[model samples]
Target: MATWHRLGLRDELLARVPFSVTLERHQIAVFLHERRFTAISNICNHKGGPLCEGRVRGEFVMCPWHGWEYSVVTGKGPAGYDEEQVPSFAVEERQDGVYVQTPPVMPRKLVKHKPSHLLETHSKTPGAPPRVLGISTTAMDEANPRFSTSDALLEHAMAMARELQTDTQLIKLRTLKFQHCEGNYSKASHACTWPCAITERDPEDQLSAVYEGLVHWADVVIISTPIRWGNASSLYYKLAERLNCVQNQITIHNNMLIKRKVAGFIITGGQDNIQAVAGGMLTFWSELGFVFPPFPFIAHSRGWDAEDMQNNVRQVKASAALREASRELVERAVDFWKMLDQNRAMMDRPMERAGRKANPLVNPEDAIV
Candidate 1:
């Protein structure tokens, strides 16, 4: 049996902007949805997005980082992911305050698997090289006015990588300068050329090189950014656009270089509204042959203070969650690599024999003869 904790008065909760409570040690988010109160782990099962800070629409809580929706009542996320049902507690209203009972123990076989074509699409081979990459584009320099949470996330991720003995690289966007040449090739003849050759040095050109390197060398990537105005910083977006150029190249080559890789995101914002940015970034990464992980790390703070970096409520929570999520990412990366290895190992086996199947390529009578 679990123990119950009395949070506060029901009237006090109703007075708050969003009626919610944070489970101090558990890091869970509890909310009042209509007549019943629902409890969900604050960390998004998909990417570590803070569910408590998210908006509740009906029975679902949409992740503020990437718009990943989860059922508040059941804690079940979208299809195709292994997400355990979030534990819900019994709530009773009293004259003095609201009381919530402890959640029940999770079932051993709670997660259900879904049929997927991902394995079929990947041709099994033997001894395929294992490659995993962690790329951080957050700028930590003093030139930017606002404090960046991306830096902290990167630091935490790097620390976890070291603990797991994972090889990762940190790429700072601010240090690289590049020129962004807008308009078609007709208007801007230097579209295909580097900015350095065109006279002045453009920061965009330098940044493009870094983007190209990341896309080319990474088999699995983790991207982190600071949210600005409900979106990733201009620096990260610009880099995203440049990376699209790699996809363009693949298209030109008839998708020969289409390498499906695993990807994850980490985002931090001032006001905590990160869904828009995370959604856009995830969509962008998906278009480039990347498989998005279920969990995303989204962190926020009310205001920026020199000392706040050390003591900010949101940042501390985010940092701890990100560390755990990064560890999971490392394990998943290893699993992905092992899957590839298994696929390679199976390639040498003889193809399975089956009854003659109809071929759309030839007429039925002609094919048999």
Candidate 2:
């Protein structure tokens, strides 16, 4: 038995070619192209983006969320991705009005994808020592390297972690080839995804190492960045932007990926504003659910006019106090993590946030507008 539901007048549908109609709990997208009417499932195959809100490019509609494209008429993906498709329906212009057939002419087809390794939320290995991860965000040429004060301190921190008998991993952002954040969140709050939209498309993106270290491997994280023009290093900001996906998980799913973890920072530069730089780092990591220990950061900076770069480098290189402070920062972070781990049950952190709330537009069904 074939069932057809009248959507609206043909002229009204033509005026609103790309629109959604929910018929008996079935949401469908209707389109007008080249004097023809076509209907397809309103939900995108990828991340359930609202297809009706997306823009039609020729015969295909590009998803507003992550730019996934599907044919408006056939609901098939472009070229090589044709096998992946959304459900398509038959639309007819009857004497009374425009009607869309129920149950779709073509069913939705999705490729069976191997889930991202970052999505695996494995419990901490029992009896295993907690891990410490150091991220050096001072960008430089790895092959023809220049000494970075921040990187040096990060090395000191890592050395301290090893001496303290904790597992340690150091990530130098300069050495890794990764893409900058492409601003998927600007498209929509739901557009930014876990594992990141860019990471899913490009396998060679090395930021996955950072994600693995922060989310799954590390109980404590130490971020080191040089002050660049009164701010954290450019590489640090780049990494921070990409990390929006991590923070967005809380806003989208109320899921905290970084619980029971601690974070500290090391900021060093000849230019001033160490406090501002450290403040930025502290605020960002806190939103990611990381707790801070006492004196959570260690920093070194000469006043703004101390632009004698060589002398500044020599000063940091010879500063035993800076090295000791770096070690102490990591120690504090590690101790905090252990303390949190020991009283994990007593702490009883809840996922339901008080001040923060999840995006109401995350669901396509509720985002009909």
Candidate 3:
């Protein structure tokens, strides 16, 4: 036999719900839906997240940790999926107030296991033949692809990397739809989580590909971006902004994610300011624990007055010298990686994270900025 416990006044219960209450050592989530009160276990079936902490959506409350939804009425999952559910309890209305019964411990339900194909890089190192990743950040319609000079150069660079028998893959940012960073770091450094809070909550985020390649797979990364208005492409910065989650791990937790990886850049534009773009990228990547090769980047700019887009396209297409230089950039990237591989023991030795010295996490609030 179970006992009923008064939670609050009936009018007040409707006003404060969906809220959480404790009864006989069991946590319960109470909600008023469709003019009736229902009680369920507050723990989410997926990760033990507090169901009352979640936002109510229609007849369901969505888990903030992974966006898994559970019905507020029956505590069941999506319709027709009776496999997962929370323990629901009996609630009654009395003249004095509303009462809820402590939910009984039900048999444990088995959660369906989901497998992932994404590879992990731990317990692996650069071998005789290196793997390279090339990222093209010039945005264009994927359905009707346009002729992009920067993308063309990036393709040439990756091909040349493969000629050296390196395993290479190209990622076109224009083909993927991923959200921009929402500046969670300003609120708190730990708020910028590793693997990102957005990616953890939203499974469809496409930036995971970039994160996996940069963190786990690649020995060398060749990024190609078309200069826009005296800076890197907007897509490049967009990707960079999302990557702040990567860097924030160092500031808050002092855990380094990127090491033993070499990065090179290829900048192309109709107008000038190539150096400024390269400089900005170098500054950011270096802070992320990446090493640069000699002449770490190469650029193709026709000065400030060369606004003839047609001529710019023709020149890059017809220039054998540019093609050869692209191949040379690949060789240099590999060579630098080989050097680092030889001295990986030294490179892997823990050093004080440079970001922490300035933005220390020891006492984040009171520390001098």
Best by TM-score: 2
Error of 2 at 230 (Å): 1.2
TM-score of candidate 2 on Cα atoms, chains taken together: 0.92
RMSD of each: 23.8, 2.5, 6.5
**TM value for model 3:** 0.69
Q: Which stretches of candidate 3 lie over 4 Å from their true place?
A: 1-7, 20-28, 41-43, 46-50, 53-58, 64-66, 87-110, 119-128, 140-147, 175-212, 234-258, 272-276, 279-291, 303-305, 314-325, 349-369
lDDT of 1 by residue, 17-73 (tens): 244455544555677677656665666543355577787888788866445677776
Model 1 weakest 10-residue run by lDDT: 360-369
Give lDDT: candidate 2, residue 306: 97
Could you tell me every candidate's TM-score relative to the true structure?
0.47, 0.92, 0.69
Expressed as tens digits, the lDDT of each residue in 208-322 for candidate 3 is 8899889888899999999899999999999999999778777766667889899999999999998899999998988777889999888898989998989999999999988
Kindly report which residue stretches of model 2 are placed more than 4 angstroms away from their true locations once superposed: 1-3, 78-83, 357-362, 365-369
Model 3 clash pairs are none
In the range 120-146, model 2's lDDT, one tens digit per residue, is: 767777879879999999988777999
Location of the lowest summed lDDT over 10 successive residues in candidate 2: 360-369
